[model samples]
Each structure stands twice: as structure tokens, then as C-alpha cells.
Target: MNLTQLNMLSDAQLAARVAQDIPDGSYVNLGIGKPTHVSAYVPEGREVIYHSENGILGVGPTPPPGQEDLELIDASKRYITLAPGAAFFEHTDSFAMMRGGHIDIAVLGAYQVAENGDLANWATLDETYPPAVGGAMDLVVGVPTIFVMMKHVNRDGTPKLLERCTYPLTGLGVVSRVYTDLAVLDVVPQGFRLVELTPGNGFEAVQAATGAKILT
Candidate 1:
């Protein structure tokens, strides 16, 4: 679908779309924000393991109202139910899992991603907007694969997937793929490659929204 049309998809629908790409036995970490929706999309019968930086593994989903444990929360501080064999530990152990390369894939949200795989999600130059780096640095370097989920363009029609990032970067060259409303792009040795386009979007339209050369 086109960028605008992509919004018509329910959160459940978006979750399903992301789940299709997950391998059967991936050990994944979903970042706060939109990436968390991936947990709801994981296909039934698959053995994917979900990890949260707040020290939970094999997380299930948001708990039903009145069923939440005030002490149990995901990285986003949202109350979540635990899956079978789910474990909780200290934050140190959590970072160890991330920094020690135990994670196979990390899906995160981004504000900007350059054609060369540079990420700029933590901060901007806006004086009124405070900055926060959070755990992005650890996730980027710790995970083998980093997939960014965000809109293709800024509010002012500026491209977020760009030839170069105008915002301050979070990681130098860490992003592996970008999943936007219009398309999916893979960062490669030769630059960004247009891997998949949304159903009703054309390559040129995506190219126009991205200020970078896209390999077909």
C-alpha cells in the first residue's frame, strides 16, 4: 500500500506483516514503541523467543486488565504477561544478553536512517526537544541484525531515509534494514537496496520519498 494507506492497517495487521519475516527460532529483542507490536504478530506454532531489556525472556503479551503484576514490566515499562519458561533478572544480566551477542535480531524504531546504514533516532538539534539515547547503542552493537521501523518521511515531507542524516546519529553504521510505510530497504555494500515495496506503492514514489539512490 501507499504510505498514507499503510495507516489503515490495524495494529494487529501491522504485527502480522512483521511476523512473516521472523525466522522460526529467532531470539529477538523488540525495541520500545512500534517494534513492540511484533510480539503480537509472531506466528502461532513458531518457537520464536522474545527478550525484553527489563529482564524478561519469552514475554507473552500485554496482560488483561486487573491481571497485571505491578512488579513485572517490559522494557517499555508496560505490564506484560509472561510466556512459558519466561525468566526475569537484573538489568545487568539484561545488558549482558544484549552486549554479549546473545540476541539474533533486534527490531527498533528510528527517526532517521541514512543510506549507508547510519541511525539517528536518539536526538535532534531542536533546542526545545530534549535528547535521550536509551539502550539503542547497546542494541545496535550487540545484535547481529538491526531492523528499523518508522515512517519514510518527516512531518514536513522531508525524507527520513536519506543520503545523509541531518539529525545527530545514534550509531555510525549499524542499521541493516528499514521497514517504512512505503517500503523495506536493505543496507548493503553498494548502499541501500529496495527490497520490498508496499502493495500499492511504486518504486519511483518510494525513491522520491527517500533522498538516496535505491538499488532495485
Candidate 2:
């Protein structure tokens, strides 16, 4: 199969796909970057509780333009509003929730995820870019399920889903599934398990794009 860009999901579309997987009444932590957008697209019938590292829990979607409160922000520092019945707490208590296994799922962006579920999202090999890992180390360990939302390829068109990660790891064998622009894949023992593909793409094209073996 040759490369084709047809039907590739935009970032918002990918965010919606991640949102649809979350179950009702689950306490979730959406990490900085693309994962933060998941807050806005949670399924209509489900009630998902959002947790943030900077002392916020039960957070809500980001406000529309001009409705933003610069003072109120999540871990990503994105201006947001609180959901009904949302609570505010101390930073230590917030981390306690993440570290104490209270978070059900954590959706995070990744630089790389290995076949065995090893995750490397914190820093690249370049020392020039200082990394801020924040609560990622804790979330991946405590949360029962980890879902990564990221691009299928780097800017230079290399696979981010790989046989092994070259970057510093945030957690080991922690990723359960990954949602990317090209496809949705689960990190199984053998390798990536195909879930669904973008329209107009075939298994061969996806296999070519990935760095690891693909298992149906």
C-alpha cells in the first residue's frame, strides 16, 4: 500500500475518539498538551471526573473565548472552568489522589511508546530542552489504565510507536493503548494490536509507518 493522507483525523477529531472510550464515573487525569483537549469532548451520557496535579479535581471543559479565567488553570496551565460540584484542594492532597490509586485512567501525550508498553514522554536526548515531567511518573504507576494521545509519526516522519524508546522513560510497561492520527492500537505482549484505521489507509501502509511488528 502506498501512502495516502485521506481521512486522517485532525487533532480535535482524535481528541473526540479518546473521549468516547472513557466510561462514566471514572476519575481521569488528562496530562498536558493534546490530552487536555479530551476534557472538552467526553461522551454525552457519561460523567467523567477530571483531576489535575495543581490542586484541582472535578475540572471541566475549557471556556469559550472571553469567558476564560486566567486565574483558574489545570496542570497544563490552560484556562478552564470547574464542572458542577467541582472541588478545590491542596496540592499535596491532589498528588495523594494520583499516587494513592484514586485515578481510574490517565490520558497522556507521549514522545514514544514501546511494544512492551514502556513509555518515554518526558525528555528527548537533547539536553537543550529541559523537561518538566510533573506528575506523569506517578499517574502512569497509579492509574489502572493509561491511554496515550499523540501523533503516529514525528515531524520528520519517523514512528513514535516503536520497538524500543530512545528517550528517558516516564514509566515502564504502563501504556495500555495509543490513539494517534493514523490509527488506534493497543500495546500487547507481542506488539501493537490493530484496533481501527483512518479511512483510506490499509494495514500495509500502517505497518510501514510503525517501527514495530503489527498484530491483528
Candidate 3:
């Protein structure tokens, strides 16, 4: 393989990969930050509907820079457009859809994920940063299938995937899969299972970068 293929996937490429995994005719909620990019790259002909907590369903892709509509924004306040058959409702009603288990999948950002699929995204242990979990608590509990999108390691060159989360957890045993810059992992009964590694990468490298033990 070309050396370039070994490079970590960019945010857009990661989003595309996540989009490819989503099945057709599903209702998905893209969490704040990186997860938001997934909707723009849904496969052609798939009828996946995007949902926003601020009261909109059937969300479309992000609009061009100059075409942004101030009133239509996502949970992160990022500008977004609506699909052809979109529907808008009260914010409470939106939570109803989620709490009622009407949502099929939810792609979220995480600060750290435990080997057993525990999620810690809202805040780190440091009291310097105030916690702003928002709808993440609700989303994890309500959404049946939770997919976490994050980097393999923290910015300080430490692993974010841990044996047990040090930060406050959003949900216990909630995550099903994790899409990181280095690999795609499944949260199995044993621990994190290596689904696939990035091109030109190896199991040893990923194991070294990860804090928790990967169950082959």
C-alpha cells in the first residue's frame, strides 16, 4: 500500500466512512462536533433521516459558507439545511422521539471510552472546565445503537480508550462501535474488539496507542 494510505483519515473522510456504515432507511442523530459531518456524506439513494434535538427531523447537509441560515442550526449551533420532507416540532417532542426509542442510531463525540463500552464525553475530571453534557445523557439512554467518533489518543499523546473511564461517564455500556482515526473497534462482551485497522497499520501499533487491552 502507498505510504499515504497509512495516514490517519481526515475529519471529512472519517465522516464518509461512518456514513457508509449506516444502513438505508434509518433515523440517525449526529452528535455535536465531528459527528455532525456524517450527514453530508450519506450514500447516494439511501433514505436515512437526520434528527436534531432543537426540533427538526429529516435534516440535510451543511450549507455552503455563504448560504448558511442563521435560524436553522444544530445542537452545536452549526448551520444546516433541511431535507425535502423534513418536519419540525417542539423541543420536548424531539426528546420524546429520542426517549421513546424512535431513533435507530446516534453518532456521538467522546472524550474517552471504556473497554466495556462506557462513554465519557461531557467533561474531564478537571474542575477547570465546566460540564456541558446537553442532550448527550438523553441520547445515549434513548438511542438503541450508539456509535462514538473520536481520536485514538488525547492531544497530550495519551490514549483516550481506557480500561475504565477516568472522566465522568455519560452512559454505561452504551456504545456499540467506535470510529477513531486509527481504527474501527467494536465493543464486545470481552472488551474492545479489533474490527479493522487503518491501511498500513498493524495490531501492535494500535495496541501501543490504546490504553485498554484489545481483545484480538
**Global lDDT scores for all candidate models:** 0.83, 0.88, 0.89
Q: Pick the candidate with the highest lDDT.
A: 3
lDDT of 1 by residue, 50-122 (tens): 9998888888878889999998888888998888888888899999999899999999888889888899888
Tens digit per residue, CA lDDT, model 3, 57-168: 9888778989998999878897888898999999899999988899999999999999988999998888987778799999999999999999888766689899999999
* Residue 126 lDDT, candidate 3, scale 0-100: 89
Q: Which is better, 1 or 2, measured by TM-score?
A: 2
- Please state the error at residue 71 of candidate 1 in Å: 0.5
Clash tally for model 1: 3
lDDT per residue, candidate 2, 1-216, as tens digits? 233543467999999999999999999999988888887788678899899898887798778999998879989888889988799999889888988889999999999999999999988999998777888999998888999999888877788989999999999999999998889999888889999997677777788888998899
Q: Point out the worst 10-residue segment of candidate 3 by lDDT.
A: 1-10
TM-score, predicted candidate 1 vs. hidden true structure? 0.92
Candidate 2 ranges with C-alpha deviation above 4 Å: 1-7, 64-69
